[model samples]
Target chain A: MGTALNPSYFMVLSAALFAIGLYGALSRKNAIAVLISIEIMLTAVNINLVAINKFLTPEAFIGQIFAIFVITVAAAEVGLGLAIIIAIYRNRHTVDLDDFNWMKW
Target chain B: MHFDFSLLTTELSMFILGLATFVLGLVVPSRSRRGIGAFALFGLLAVLGLTVLNWDQQGVLLNGMYLVDRYAMFFKILCLSTAILVIFGSLRYVNEHLGNHFEYYSTIVFATLGMMVIASAGDFISLYLGIELMTISFIILVAFRSQDGKSLEAGIKYLLQAGLSSAVILYGFSLIYAATGTIVILEVAHATLQGQASPLLIAGMVMLVAGLGFKVSAVPFHMWSPDVYEGAPTPVTAFLAVGSKAVSFAALLRLFVAGLAGVHQQWDILVAVLAALSMIIGNLVAIPQTNIKRLLAYSSIAQAGYLLVGLVTASPAGIKAVMFYSFLYVFATVGAFTVVAVVYNKIKSDEIADYAGLVQRAPLAAAVMLICLLSMAGIPPLAGFVGKFYLFSTVVSGYLWLVYLGLIMSMISVYYYLRVVLVMFRDDPKDPAPIEMGSAANITLIITMVATIFLGIYPNPLSEVANSAAISFFLK
Candidate 1:
């Protein structure tokens, strides 16, 4: 192998992913789209964790273990999020975020 | 490597209870499913009793991933009681409005179990698991009334916000893990103290605070609360307000005052600012709420501000005050929500204007609402008053400005809390219909009301308990 890539490279990649995910989650008008955005953010977190485990905390694999836990939680959260979206869709026949205006400040 | 069985008895029992309730819901006949709420209540009460019995069984498990200290036990007992009351108070509402789905009770039980775990979480992994478990269950519970548009709307809103916050927290945790190379809170604190304060570490801390602040509905992160509270089922609203909010505070205490003790100087001003913003924004926004649930939601945010005062002090006395205030808040919020559930069950409206002449319609409920609202407003001779005093006094030596801001906010909060009160007593009856309440709701209201008053008068006993709980983490 020539030379190992710096951990900062992975960090930058994950941070970029996190920013994009945050943007999508904030600006998306569709509930499904929002859920997907959140998933992307979670995936960015997982990447950060795995990279840190590989480079920084290699002795314990602690970051990888956290990544695994995060993935599991993300899976569970998506399942619940989809279920809630379906529930909302059933009531209003739409999943558009703007249509969820039955409640307002 | 030895695991202490007694240290986890309350959590273990609660987990078993949640599983049993879910199974029981499946086996019971659909028509008879309503009994599951009472069954869950019974199991929760037993778990509450277990928490009290294990009050002195302080120990560590799984290499300090879980704790059974007095602090955790006190909050566990508080969570159990709040869960029990939620079940009881929502029993009739669930039966009528939500059609007695057994999943309703089972999910609440699971959520309560999650809260118990959160109360004892000694590591980041446990805290994350506990929080996700609780919020996931809440998302389902908030949409329990699937046919209602508002309920579904609330569920979706809560889901989106909860998901975003969870992602934020995970990112923050990943950063902390990068900086400290550990996920165990105690070890992380040690690492932080031993190492120079890297900019990465402080950024991670800020992210963590922002994420957790959303969980507690602190200002700037609190946009989701009023809508979610208004649209969710009333019983669930109560659970969200009291049980979930209290457990968030418990976790905050662990993370801030204990887990991050070595870096207190960096986070103290951040916490104070969050508290100040929450108090001002929550109270100010609550003034315009027309729906009772929304008003209470904003008020709950203000309460979170007051609770944050305890954390801002960064002292054991502050933690004790937080525990005591959380205790008092459970009763007051639950009492108020119980009455709201009763009223809504009869009148089918949550609007404050719909509550005109509530005194004439339901004298007991009106009185309970009065007491709860007044207590929330921090009026003297009530539990909220004493709780606020403890919190403010604890921090006054260094943070006098916070106390003054809290005092002014408390005064401002009075206008809105009493707005509901004045409508109930001073306005003419809109419907003038006699409200019929089930025995469970009546019992819940009475128990919470009495506890609110009793704790206000004799806070010494609970204060002692809180002091012991606060000492558990601080002394180490």
Candidate 2:
């Protein structure tokens, strides 16, 4: 064999992507940006699942199946998120997380 | 593998009911929409009856993807009863404030379906799907009053926070699957028992605790609740408090006790810390809230902390305590929020001061609110006290510190609860006119109050049921 690809490399990449997405989700001011960051986080999770399925659990496709379900559910989540964002924007004319503070303690 | 479709009678019936309600809402004229609420109510009652009838039946479906046992049936009963009571309480509110009564009722049914699904989930995929089903329906319901800015804001807030938490949970599930090479919860337990503890499994377990902690509104992850509670409609808030929280606990128990039992030593202390913090922060923060809904939100956070004590023990007795507390909690919370919804309808305000001298205006509502709040405070001869006694007793040996903290927090909780009672009973009403209540609201209030008091006085029946449920959980 010329070279071997280690599953650890994919795990590291997935972890890095997850960390970046988490940071963006917490720090982004725009509602849409926060949603995008959530999508990125979900994508990272999917990557992790698929990589694990390919390496450790090659006989069982459970991880890949789970990733598919995640993708489908993530789509539905984003759809609802965008609809709510639009509804709020229509009322308040802003998508800034800062402006959404109408009811705080 | 053969599928036993009959095992799914309750869920199928509930789904059909939701579909029927939605279709009827479309076909019927707007003038007759009020009857649909009653339609949904009776349908839920039927489903509740079915679930209770199937209480003793036990089986696993699809190689343990769906489970039908007394434990799952117990939660199914809780979720169904909560939905029924909420619908009965909110009938007038939905007809008056919300434009689409059918959608409101149907979404509640769908949300109940989601809770039932979570209760029976044997695999991670079903659990996630059930949670999303419930959550997505709630998102629509929260924003039902689309014209109101506050409602819209609450919907967005719930959507974002809930989405983020779900992603976190899914990531944890992925990690757990990677560690065990199996997604079945029991198989994961077996794998953990056979293999040495690895960083991958430990990290996954911690993530599971954190994500489920958010769902249960434990201290550090409880920031989303007060805002969502205050901004959403009162009935939705009540459903969130009773139905959503109870079912999340069910999921948490299933995942932690069933799937992660091999690593119980690793997580027990972490859970104990969460329980302590929730009891402290949830009670202290509640004292300053002026909105009755927000106050209830914080009290519920405290209640979540008390419920977590049972999980910390990870024993059959602990499971029984959680189930018992959850059952009584439904009545007290629904009773309080029914009064809130009715009062808000009349006064058009949620500020605590607006409730001054409520005893003079609506004696029954005021009395029910007082009793419910007291029950939540764990006062003697109340359901909450018995519930707390059971929970705290389970940890007497290892978690004695938690019991002390719980006692002190219960005392602190009483102060805030009594503040509301004082405003309702002692102070003068701003408007001296008596508040009128619909017959439906009256019935709901009376049932809840009776249940709360009766359960406190005679806790045997429900506790026995919970005992059997807990036994079934371990038997599997």
Candidate 3:
């Protein structure tokens, strides 16, 4: 049953998700939404890691461990992001990306 | 399964020192936290001492997850001194504007520890963790002045971009993992050569360059730097410019020149293009910067471009040039920023125009800034000149075009750097009062200024150390 779907299918799905996530990350106006997009992209990376681990390298669990590390690091990053976002919001009253431009080139 | 305890001594000491500084920061009263900077300075000095004591203790530890070698030691020394100088520069500003946040001292220590780890990272896991540790610490440090909107904005921008780049780098790592079926860097190098280039591997390598390129602030990835430098406290900006950028180069040199030697042909051109773009864009953008910090940011970006030229050589001399330049860079960049912080503390301005008559107000600072900027402009009789000469000479035979572009752009850079110098010496002061700076800041400026000139006049000792470090990595 597990062999019913090909690994390339998962790869394609991961690529599509990554493209969407990257587009949203760059284009989104809201800071939180941009963060969510970054998370989505990270999730896509996890799928690639896990799929490759399960299908290609069954002998080694390196990919699984890497996936775990990524998840943990991403959690910490989100926590830092939220703290900074709150700080910005308290001072400026908005998390809009455009509104955050006080210091220009 | 042999673990080398001696090989881990410097890093272990640094880790303990970071924890101690953090606890000390927490226990001390807010007003008394002024002493925390001194504590951090002592801790960093201890770590530097350990690094020197263990300089020749080279081995692989944690099953090759970490390496203790001359390459790492050279960078460790550079990073530690950069942190110490930054702390020295920060003492007065932290006491005055930052309200005795002892945590400021600890975060920098932690950041220095992270950079040291990056310098020693022998595998992908350690590399990723090291980079994340440094970047996260920098984010918090950048936002240390939480009440300041500009600082908060800089922190958020750093967070968003750094997070995105981390994700991208991870994805690249995953691809490399899939292609090679290993995360150990040395193993990956062997596997990549045996299997040669696949589309997945090629894409992975490109993403790796792009991600690390962001860390080094190469053009197209350098947009965050000017704003972040302008907003962050001046001392942290110096740390970001010198320590963070140098660590990025350390990791990059390890990964590319050592871990991916087989694929050098594939990525060398990519690095060359990035170097050219960074040189052209960084210098051109710097010409128009009125904010002194932003100008330094752009100048640092241009410096990164110059450093990247060494990467194009793909030889032992190239690495030596990079290591030597990184050492010289710490003195020039930190020295300049210390003076900037001193002035900002006095005048509450970062505008270049406001720096008019700085020589009359603070002759020593003006002089230090002059030497540092002159060094950065690659003028003769300064460390920057010798560093650039070494870098260009190494690459001239192989990448003459890059050398030409670097020489021309650095010439262009002299214009902006000298503009600041002219403003300092030529213009009249609006406030006719001498700028007062703490003795520690003055000491840091004097030491860095002396080191810059000494290194310029006498390059043999540092050049030899850099060459040894370079030889150790490429030989393996």
Candidate 4:
């Protein structure tokens, strides 16, 4: 309704959140922490989708539907990621990304 | 709005086969799990036949969410055939190295189904879901050897990187939706054509390229591939090399050519840059690798670069070239990795040096490896040479620079490929023990080797099919 709460404002917020999440995902040493940062990025995507749906195309709810799919996929990804991390932990007794140098990166 | 279920027979059958494998795996005794691989193999073969039977059928379903066309059918066949060959070639490897045969076979089926779905996806939603299905299944398969630390590490690395890339892709899709207000690809193309190019759309396009670039293992985003290939079981690496890369290219062609044709001028140069970088970097990095799997991994990256060269042209000829190359690539990769899997099962080593005197030990394996690697190196009178000819020929008029670079990089690639050949032929074996080959693996080798040579000599048939498939892409 007001310019203060417009689509551009929401877009900017989403962009900021996405950038922060990307930074955390890249810079974090812990595998689980990196997974959480990825979740943050997906959440930012959800916000962007819903905001765009409400402000730009209310007649069609494709963006909102897409956001739900993203949430579902992100949950599955985190589940698999954690399982993999645990598997590595059992073998090496560590979950630090730096310890994953068994193969040269 | 009645849908034609017949158009989906291949996909539905593949899903049911996967479920059957999983459930049967639970009921069957561990000692007899080898039957499950045979069951999976036959089931996939049946699905491959069904896909061929439905080759001419084409339709749209769910208001553009799903599509069935010759273009999609071609990729479906590729995915199914690749799955079949991988299973056939690695039956012994799976029984020996992997603990759960049922889960292994079932996940491969599901991943193949994902590739088929991605091939037929009409909109962004189906595309994203298909990609996740494939990636999640691959993550599990990559970590299937839970006792092996390297396998686990590769799995975790793939998980983190794939998760981050998918999120970036999702964000890009959201921005594109915000700008165009549609997720159906055709409608999005229409909207984009009508509207002025905005900063939102441009940013979205860039992000999309970056994310998919990771999936295809193009340079700058290819860091995860060599590690994953080296650590994952040889069979999984083979499938990842052929099936996954081909499907990603399929999705790229669909998105860039059909959905984003309106913004061709904006993204073509970006794709060209990725292609040049991947070709140069992938070939150059491959030369120094000692591990056979990692060497193929880098070679596959370079192949991805060559495939991207087709996308740069964005013409019917370009699509045809990509399809032709992808089909032949499946054979070469499966042949090469089958040799790797068989050799690893015997010697328990993937280093190129271990393959010394391989010709005296297992001549079929040695010869298949030689032909497959030479084909990938684009030697004359081989399938890879013809595929590269088509690809480079498509961009010869305008992108002469790419052609020159491709020629130089391909020559560089031959050096590494021949290095392995030299080891197999020249060096003496440390053990000098003969390796036993499985009947199934031998069959796979013969098929791939024959197909590679035959297709090179007679490229007309496959090229005709590819031409028709490419034509169908624009018929929509």
Most accurate candidate by DockQ: 1
Write down the lDDT that model 2 would get: 0.92
User: How do the candidates rank by lDDT, highest first?
Assistant: 4, 2, 3, 1
lDDT by residue (tens digit), candidate 1, B1-476: 67668677877788888889889989888888777877888888888887787788867777778877888888888888888888887787888898968888889888988998899898888999999999999999998888888888888899999999999988888888888888888888788878887877887888899999999999889989999999899999999999999999999989888777778999999999999999999999899999899999999999999999999868888899999999999999999999999999988899999999999999989999999999999898999999999999988888999999999999999999999999999999967878889788888899999998989888999999898888987655
The sequence of per-residue lDDT tens digits that candidate 4 reaches over residues B1-476 is 69888878988998999999999999988888879998999999999999999999989998889989999999999999999999999988888899655899999999999999999999999999999999999999998899999899889989999999999988888989988988888787788778888889889989999999999999989999999999999999999999999999999999889988888889999999999999999999999999999999999999999999999979999999999999999999999999999999999999999999999999999999999999999997999999999999999998999999999999999999999999999999998889999899999999999999999999999999999999999997
Give me the TM-scores of chain B across the candidates.
0.98, 0.99, 0.99, 0.99
TM-score versus the correct structure, for each prediction? 0.98, 0.99, 0.98, 0.99
- Candidate 2 residue runs with Cα over 4 Å from true position: none
Question: Which parts of model 3 have CA positions greater than 4 angstroms off?
Answer: A1-6
Candidate 1 CAPRI-style tier: high
**Clashing residue pair totals per candidate (backbone < 3 A):** 0, 0, 0, 0
| Model 3 lDDT tens row, B1-476 | 66668787887888888888889878877667777778889888888988888788778887678988899999999999999898887688878888777778878888888999999999888999999999999999999899999999999888889888888888888888778887788888788778778888888888899999999999989989998999999999999999999999999888888777778889999999999999999999999999999999999999999999899867899999999999999999999999999999999999999999999999999999999999999998999999999988987787889989998999999999999999999999999899988799989999999999999999999999999998888655
Chain A vs. true chain A, TM-score per candidate?
0.96, 0.97, 0.95, 0.94
- Per-residue lDDT of candidate 3, residues A1-105 (tens digit): 665876788788888988899899999999999999999999999999889888888897877888898899889989989989998999999999999898998
Backbone clash pairs for candidate 1 read none
Q: What is the lDDT of candidate 3?
A: 0.90
Regions of candidate 1 where Cα sits further than 4 Å from its true position: none
- Tens-place lDDT digits, model 2, residues B1-476: 68999899999999999999999999999888878998999999999999888888889998888999999999999999999999998888877788666889999999999999999999999999999999999989888888899999889888888888887888888889888888887788788878887788888888888888988899899999998899899999999999999999999999988889888989899999999999999999999999999999999999999999999978999999999999999999999999999999999999999999999999999989988999999998999899999999999998889989999999999999999999999999989999998999999999999999999999999999999999999877
Model 3 residue B167 CA deviation (Å) reads: 0.9
Evaluation by DockQ, superior candidate among 1 and 4 = 1
**In model 4, what lDDT does residue B391 have?**
97
